[model samples]
Target chain A: MATVAVENYLKHVLLLSEGGEELVSMGDLAGALAVVPGTATAMVKALADEGLLEHQPRLGVRLTTRGRRIALNVLRKHRLVETFLVETLKMDWSKVHAEAEQLEHAVSDEVLDRLDALLGHPRQDPHGDPIPNRAGKIDSQVYATLATCATGRRLRIVRVTEQSEEFLRFAEDSGLRPGAELSVGERNLVSGLVTLTRTDGGKIALGVAAAGKILVEPRG
Target chain B: MATVAVENYLKHVLLLSEGGEELVSMGDLAGALAVVPGTATAMVKALADEGLLEHQPRLGVRLTTRGRRIALNVLRKHRLVETFLVETLKMDWSKVHAEAEQLEHAVSDEVLDRLDALLGHPRQDPHGDPIPNRAGKIDSQVYATLATCATGRRLRIVRVTEQSEEFLRFAEDSGLRPGAELSVGERNLVSGLVTLTRTDGGKIALGVAAAGKILVEPRG
Candidate 1:
């Protein structure tokens, strides 16, 4: 059985590496796991020894095929659990991520499949993170963010890229969730602020870094 | 947060003691937890020190009021999860006990409350085991079992006392679940056999010990 630590390590690697192929720096991995750099290094070495990852000496690490398979499954469990918590339980969108973090490891494939069916096989979680399918495949398409999209043209939020719960609560309050229509009113990178104009004629200002986490697509 | 092992130990102690006030022998606790006697003793001592339980050296252990509160909460999560699996997810009743065992530890109180409401605040799980409420109170009403019910009396199965997966599967196939109507056709203690006659005119024989686990009530 994969221990929670092992599952978490692999999942973090899959998340850090785009398309599960790029090398993940030890510093970023340690930051993601909230572990000391040495601790992260030791775990990555052990995983590499187990053929779950390729630890490139001092360069970095990437998951092996088998490791990606396990990581994808854990991701599936996490996102589906989040979806269940929010959609079925009517829990707060900002709170479900933390709840799902603990439940992801405990949920079996059987329970996850049942939850997936119950949620009508959602493609994305409440935060708009794409759910990896059972075959370890994910939708990796990129979308423009508030920091990059054309200003004043109608754009719909596609994903919130859930980070801190505080950020999520703020996003929810601003009506910035996925499928909500908005356009950039102002993007002053040097000032590190962006003003979003909602379809409801509401305006909200966010830090440029925060604005970058909200993925969006232009409305035709 | 209570660790999974701590939750299991407390729950099992509550189960072995009919009213959660009786002394549960170390031998029974060990058997229920599948831990060696030494391990059970060591854990009991730790719990006693923490004021969760009272351990009688070389004899047994019993839950303190604080311990009972936690134990009841765990039981509530377990039975409610089992009910959701069966009544909502359409999972096989025989397999849900094991699934609930894992979920009970992972489910948060908030999520459980939502599930309880979603399940219509069910008083009992599909197995007919009473679910504890938010106040940590449980229904402990006693009911006669097939081994003790009057022969040829019309009876209704109220609970099956879920034990093993094999037994539950067998019970399901025998139409011996809760709410099923049946009658104790015969019970021969000397031969250690009990015959159950279903209302559909089907008959089945079980060991006296097995019959004792099937709680039933005389249908007036």
Candidate 2:
């Protein structure tokens, strides 16, 4: 059985990879985990020895099948727990991430299965992140974001890809949650700003980089 | 911030003390924790240094007010989680103890409060153990067990005090869960056996030792 620390490292690596055939740089991994680069390197080397991941000297790291499986399982527990906290417990969505971080390592597969069933096997979490199925397969279909979607086209917010408490609170206040209907009003790349008009006709403006974190799709 | 091991140690100390003024012996503490006597002693000494507990040479260890507070909080978490598992999740009462062991350390105070409310602020867990309140106060009322209660009276089972899988399975099979109404049919002191007749006209036989674990109260 992998220790909690090992599971955390693997999950962070998989998150950094972001469903792509890319290596996660040591600096980025270290930053994500809030660990020093040297500490991340030592731990990465240890994980490589266990055959859970591959480490390339001075370049980056990638998960092996075994590591990915564990990471996906951890991720499944995390998102499902977040769903339970917000949907069942009526907790604030912006705060459930921290709670889920502790619970993911503690929940058993049996309890998780029950939670999944209770939640009706939700396709995605409250934040619009797709939940990985029991088989470790995740839905990675690409979607347009507020930054690049065509202006004046009806759109539905599909995801908010960041867990920043500040941003999520703002999104909640602005009625920008997943499944909320809106349209891009203006995109000024020169000024690095994007403005959205909600179906309620409420206008919200964001910097280009922050706007990119909100994934959306053209409404029917 | 107590580590998981530290919480486990303190909880065991409180448990073995049995709600009375008594010190926990190193031998019993080690046995409960499945640690060596030396290890238990070392840990007790360290806890004493931190003023979490008072360790008396060759006598035993006892929790100070600070230690007791933490232990009670952990106990509250454990019992509340067990209640949620069985009452909300519809899990087997006999199996929830192990699950709660993992969750008690992971659940935060905020989540615990919500769960407590969600479960309608339960005062007792599934097995009939009292849950500590947020203020660290616990209900420790004493009750008679089948082994010593007056025979030939209408009685209700109040608690099953052991978490032993085999014994709990037997209890479940016998329909002797908490709130079960039954009357003692006979007590053969020489044979060390106790016989019970349920209100539904079912008979169950148990050894005196097993009978003592089933606490009860007289039904009006």
**Top model by TM-score, which number?**
1
Off by over 4 Å in 2: none
Give the B-chain TM-score of model 1. 0.98
| lDDT by residue (tens digit), candidate 1, A1-220 | 8899999999999989977478999999999999999999999989999999999988999999999999999999999999998888999999998998899998999999999999999999988999998887899989999889889899999998856889999998889999899889988878999998988898899998888899999987
List DockQ, one per candidate, in order: 0.85, 0.85
- Model 2 clashing residue pairs (backbone): none
Error of 2 at B112 (Å): 0.8
Model 1 superposed RMSD (Cα)? 1.1
Candidate 1, pairs of clashing residues: none
Cand. 1 TM to true fold: 0.98
lDDT of 2 by residue, B1-220 (tens): 8999999999999999986769899999999999999999999999999999999999999999999999999999999999999988899998999999999999999999999999999999999999999999999999999999999999999999999878898899999999999999999999999999999999999999999999999997
What fraction of the real A-B contacts shows up in model 2?
A: 0.71
Off by over 4 Å in 1: none
Residue B171 local lDDT, model 1? 95
Candidate 2: tens digits of C-alpha lDDT, residues A34-151: 9999999999999999999999999999999999999999999999999999999999999999999999999999999999999999989999998999999999989998998899
TM-score of chain A of each: 0.98, 0.98
Reference-based TM-score of each model = 0.98, 0.97
